[model samples]
Target chain A: MSAREEVLARLRAARDVGGSTVPDVPRDYHRTGVHAPGSAAAVERLTETLTDYRATVHRVGDLDGVPAAIAAVLAGSSSVVAPPGLPGEWLGEVTATVRRDDPPLSVADLDRLDAVVTGAAVAIADTGTFVLDALAPDQGRRAISLVPDHHVCVIRAADVVSSVPEALARLAPDGPLTFVSGPSATSDIELDRVEGVHGPRRLDVVLIVPPRA
Target chain B: MTTDLGMPTVASDPHGHLRGTEPFPVAAHRALADTQLRQNLGHATRTIRAKRAAVVGEVDDWEELRRAGECVKADVMARLPELLEQLEASVTARGGVVHWARDAEEANRIVVGLVRETGSDEVVKVKSMATQETGLNEALGAAGIAALETDLAELIVQLSDDKPSHFLVPAIHRNRSEIRDIFLREMPDVDPDLTDEPRRLAMAARAHLRRKFLSARVGISGVNFAVADTGTISVVESEGNGRMCLTLPDTLITVMGVEKVVPTWSDLEVFLQLLPRSSTGERMNPYTSSWSGVTPGDGPQTFHLVLLDNGRSNVLASPDGRQALHCIRCSACLNVCPVYERTGGHAYGSIYPGPIGAVLSPQLTGIDGPDDVNASLPYASSLCGACFDACPVRIDIPHLLVQQRAAAVEAHGRPTAQDLAMRAAAAAMASPGRFSLTERVVKLGRLLSRSGRIRSVPGPGAAAWFGARDMPEPPAETFREWWGRRERS
Candidate 1:
């Protein structure tokens, strides 16, 4: 028998012998938090959680506020890269050399950039996590956000979710997803968390909340 | 670059890092003698324990989440065969080739062949417990392929030719200065002024592995969770090495234990919430990359998923023992364990260590005899029940430990001296007169002790006790006798 067949057979025998007890998955855990999605309370909680992990979060008022927010965090950056779908006006205030990822940037090309700007697919308020879908025109490829030292993620109001389950619902299984909470960190050294490692060391989240309805 | 720890043997499949060089007690004895190991383990575990407590405390529904997590894992275990088939099909539909291996040797053979086919002599790796379990790096090395461990702690262990002592931080046994020394001695073209500061050390590693990450042709990692419906593979890590290895490499080969497969994409919500908080005490880890098979032009063009069923089926066959397969390799149990805190990871002698390893390793390879090295594992725990509380999946580790201990005793065939002694003591305790007489006899040890602690006992069963610790002085009177005197008064 093929290895696959034999292995499956073994598992079947084990399940049979163990008297396959189909377990009931109790989903009573809080699927949603106290705050509603995209609510001011949710965004505030997002900011608090992101800042708690040492990521600088900027609460921007609509699309016009995004470019300045992105630029402010990229003050000392020499070069910046963003997806082709990112509005050119978003980098209008930035002095850094701009390279839009129309043609996907090589890893070596990405390494030279000081900062990366990309729009997120979804943001989770409870965990302060944002999902980056590589297939998404705004998010571009996974490497662009990762290789650069600084990552400036623009999270629009519509994209914010209240919790993890909500975030998963918004994301597709494909698109090669990356869930980033904060900048790269390691607790490997004496289990003491020191932020900054191989990934973007400085993460700046631009919250583009709409004007009060 | 593994240490020369002896392989645990059951004769059927004698591979993987499930067993250590010697029995747990003998290895633990040596581990107990090392003050440095103790201090390192003590500090690291305590630091993580506090961090975990704080983060876990933030969740109002943490217990509810744990119950969901446990039941989901149980469901996965019960229906593993079907779930695996669905996973294989989904992954195949998305342009991944699925390979199954009955044991470690087959798994290694399949991986080495894939790497050889990629024609890459070197591969960068994310920290993976599955590969470590199968000793894939050693197998790759023997096949003339250099597998560089990209995670900082794993790199330290790999560089020094040491074994991982902890699940998350492989080099938790080594202090910062020791790491600097290792880097200085081993890392070529390293800066002479590199200090023991963690950030500096992390920067040094970033500089070292950057080129390899950028250029590596093949990458190997273990799956944290494989969504059976979506065929998505997830790798959770604090450092971006996981991102580097997962994205940059053209050909990605992931070795996943069969038990890692989850039924659906939504299952990840529970795990994603449970894992980081439970493992590193983060609301969410720094990076969690999920790819369903191959993602064309975006990440690795080619992907391979090797499903390993080394000893997991054996663990699953036994109803009570099946909970061992529910482990997500969080190492939360380890960080909170008293025995693990004292002896560190090395004493368990397996790649897996701590409270989880005690029940897990022995079951992975059945206890062969009374003296089998893995047999001694069930006895390694003090069974404080902290491991159960700390476990995100709520694996009753103490229950499993006692179960494994029973299996060990049964595996011993004829009654051992300890078994006989317990049986005899039980017999005496069943009779009121004999119970009093037995208590009187136990109190006789006080006569031979000057310091009220028995240093030695001239008997067959006493050697194992006296070798490590003193026997406490018996009470002056039994409770029954004291009750009788009080009634008379």
Candidate 2:
């Protein structure tokens, strides 16, 4: 018999001998946030959680506020890599030279850049996490957000969800996704958390909140 | 007893089973004397334990989540064969190729063959327990391929020529100064003024791994969770080394145990929540990258998934033992285990250590022989239930420990002095006549007592116990005799 056959047979025999039955899963955990979805409280909680993880959270009123927020966050950046299909006006007020990655930048090129400005597909408020799908225009490929030293992500208030289950519901399961909670960190040494290792050291989340009517 | 396809003994393949040369007690004794190791372990485990407790306490439905996680894993085990077939189909439908390995030798051969096909002599690696279990690095080295461990802790263990002592932090046994010395000696272009500060150590490792990540053609990793429905594989880590290895390489080979698979993508929500909080005490880790087979113009274009069944089926054979497969490799059990916190991971001898390892390694290797280190592992624990409480899936490790002990004793065939004592005690307790006679004879213990306690025991098997502890002297009168006197009055 082939190795595959042997393994399958062994598994079958084990299952038969064990005679175990699968039990129904109980999911009584909170699926929604304490604050209503897309509410002001939800945004505030996300900001607090993100800040706790050491990601600078910038609250902007709307799309018009994005350019100023981007400029303020990238004040010291000399050059920034912007993904293809990113709103050009988001970087309008920034003095840093904008490098468009329509053809995608090399890893070395990305490494040299000051920061990468992109948009997130969805954000989780409770855990303070953001998902980036490569197929999404503003998110670009996984390399842009990772290779640069700093990352300034633009997240709309509407995209923020309450919990992990709600966040998973919005993502494409088969697409390449990177769920980043904060700047790269490690607790490997002495169990002490030291931020910044291999990935972007600085993360700035720009919250694009809609102004109250 | 054997039929059709005669199973090859696990001993035939040297790397298939991992067991220490010395018994656990002998190894633990040496470990106990190492005050430095004890201090390091005490500090790390306490810090991690407190952090995990704080985060886990925040969740109101933590118990429910744990139960759900257990059920999901149990379902996977019950339907493992079908799920594996579905996973193979899903992965193959995408651009990935799936290979099956019955043991470590075949797994190593398949991985080496793939690397040879890529024409690459070096492979960058993410921190993978599966690779460690298979001793993949050693196998690759024997085949003339360099497998560079990219994770910081793993790099420390690799550079120092030491085995990993912890699951999350492989070099948890080493202090900061020790790491500094290892880097200065092993790292080629390390800074001369490197200090014992953790940030400096992390920076030195990052700089050392950068060159390899940028130029490597092939990368090797292990799967944290393989979604059978979407053919997607996820790697969760606090550092970005996993992302670098998973993305930059042209060819990627992942070795995953068959039990790592979940039924669907939605099932990840529970694990993604349970793992980080339980393992590193993070709401979510710094980075969690998931991808289906291969993506064009993006991550690795060539992907191979090696499904490993290295004694996992053997573990699944027993009803009580099958819960060992429910482990998520979180190391929560290790952090809370009293035995592990004292002896550390090395005393267990396998790459896997702690309470989970005590049950897992022995079952995986089978405790059928007298001299097997696995047989000794069943006795490594104090039967404390801390590991079960810390376990995200609630594996009932104490119950498994007792069960494995019984199996180990049976495998030994010859009864030791302790076993004889237990048997005699059982026989004496079986009959009322024997019990009363034994109770009447128990007054003789007063003759051996000094002051109010017996300082030493006479038996060879119990000398060690009594050497450190004192037993109280027997009462002047038996309970039955006292009751009779009361009745007479």
Candidate 3:
């Protein structure tokens, strides 16, 4: 028989003999919740976990106060990096110089930018991780969210899920998805934890609660 | 169809010598004698084990996440061929190339040729188990190309010329002082004065590796997952070095095991949560990089994915044994294994070590006689279920270990002495008459000691039992004989 045929035979034999057995899941892995908590509860949980990881979280009750919140975080920054698809309402809160990430910005320009603000694709309520697909209007080239020292991400309560399985069911297949659990951190140096080795130093989560219907 | 990172999977079998064609007793004996190694392993494993337990306990849903991870891997393995073809189609459509290998030689050749085409002598690497298993670094060295290990622990191991002692911490067998000595000796153009302080050592390494990072044109890596639904390869790491290697280079080559595929991008959720908690004892790792084929202006323009088999198909053959492939390389099992705590990873003699290694090595490269340590690998574990409990994939490792041992015994045709002992034991056990005779003979020994302990014994049993532990002596009178006498009275 040919090598290919031999491989095929072996694979066929393996399939025939190696019948599938359902792997034993631990009995105590109870994730079933009859009433999925509302978006507000999820946002609250996200903020709590985010802060627990030492990330700075800001709360904006309305779009009107967003600029103040962004400005307060930026304090006297020379310029702000903004994605081309960023919502106008989101940036009305920031007073810093706005530089769109769409244009070819020099390394010096990126370094000078105080921070970048964008929306997440999915936010896991279980682990409080935010997913960015670069498809969001405000989320620019992957590098923009990554290279900047500070990153501010907006999350709606409706996008939150109780667990990763629930989150996986929500993410789309044909897009760029970047899951941000917390600010970039490393423990490579003798297991002594350090923050912002390559990515953002400060991560601010803006848990925007939609008005009651 | 190109970005930056150069392809270094071009080198053939960079780690070839590690396959363990040597005898297990010899390898294990040498490893056990290293006092420094024992101290290093004992300390390193204990520390990681405690941290993992503490972090894992904090999350109530850890078991659920582990189950999800295991199920997803099983599903992928079941539908692997179709998923792989789909992955290839998606990658090819997005302007990426895919290469297939049946074994280590084929894989090495494909990678080496690719690197030779890049016309580069050095390549940066992410810590990839696939490369380690295939011996890609050694292969690269043979081809006169240097494979620079960028992961901190891996870098330390490479500089010291020692094998990785643990899955997660490669230099787990080295203490701070040893690491400092290795750096001072091996590091090119080092400062005259170097302290044993970790931060200072890290700074030195950073300074040392910074030039390699900037200068290297090619990068080789292994993926944590390759999403078939979207045609993207993903890497999850604690260090941003993975990102630098993934991004800055001109050509990129990723060697992925067939078992690392997931059916959809959505499935990443299960693994994202599982890998971090199990691996680094964290809620989430810092950097997770995913790229599909190639993009016009960002990341590596020339992308090549080498689909490695190397004996995974053989593993997928056994009924109970196939579950070994579901492991996520989290190293949680190693951290919890008591046997692994003492003997360490080097004793296993495979790139994949610990409980996973016990079952996996025998299957991958069959249970061979004479110079094969892989056969004896099954005996390295104490059959404790800690590995199974700690396993993120929930592989029933003890069951597999027993199964492998059975296969080994059958293959070796059984030792004559063991066969004779088993026959005698069975005969004694089957008949009450023969058993009573043996009991009567042992009754005199109980007269010597009132204590429920045996000081020593004579013959083969004595030698085997007394080697590591003490054995208790026999009783004064047989129960049957005492009963008979009472009935007569």
CA displacement after TM-score superposition, residue B288 of candidate 3 (Å): 2.6
Off by over 4 Å in 1: B1-16, B436-440, B472-489
Q: Which ten contiguous residues of candidate 3 chain B have the minimum total lDDT? A: B1-10
Model 1: which docking level applies?
A: medium
Q: What are the clashing pairs of model 2?
A: none
Please give the TM-score that candidate 2 achieves against the real structure. Answer: 0.97
Model 3 lDDT tens row, B91-205: 8988889887766776777888899999999999999988888888878888998999988779899998888866677777777788789999999888859987765676677
| A148-203: candidate 1 lDDT, tens digit per residue | 99999999888887789989988898869999989999988899898888999999
| Model 3 DockQ (Cα-based) | 0.27
Over the stretch B332-434, how does candidate 2's per-residue lDDT look in tens digits?
A: 9999988899999999988789998999888888876677777888788878798988899889999999998988888877877778888889998999899
Q: Tell me each candidate's RMSD, in Å, in order.
A: 3.4, 2.0, 5.7
DockQ leader: 2
- All candidates' chain B TM-scores are 0.95, 0.96, 0.90
Residue lDDT tens for model 1, B373-439: 8888888888899999999999999999999988898998788778888999899989899998999
lDDT scores for all predictions? 0.89, 0.88, 0.72
Ranking by DockQ: 2, 1, 3
Better of 1 and 2 by DockQ: 2
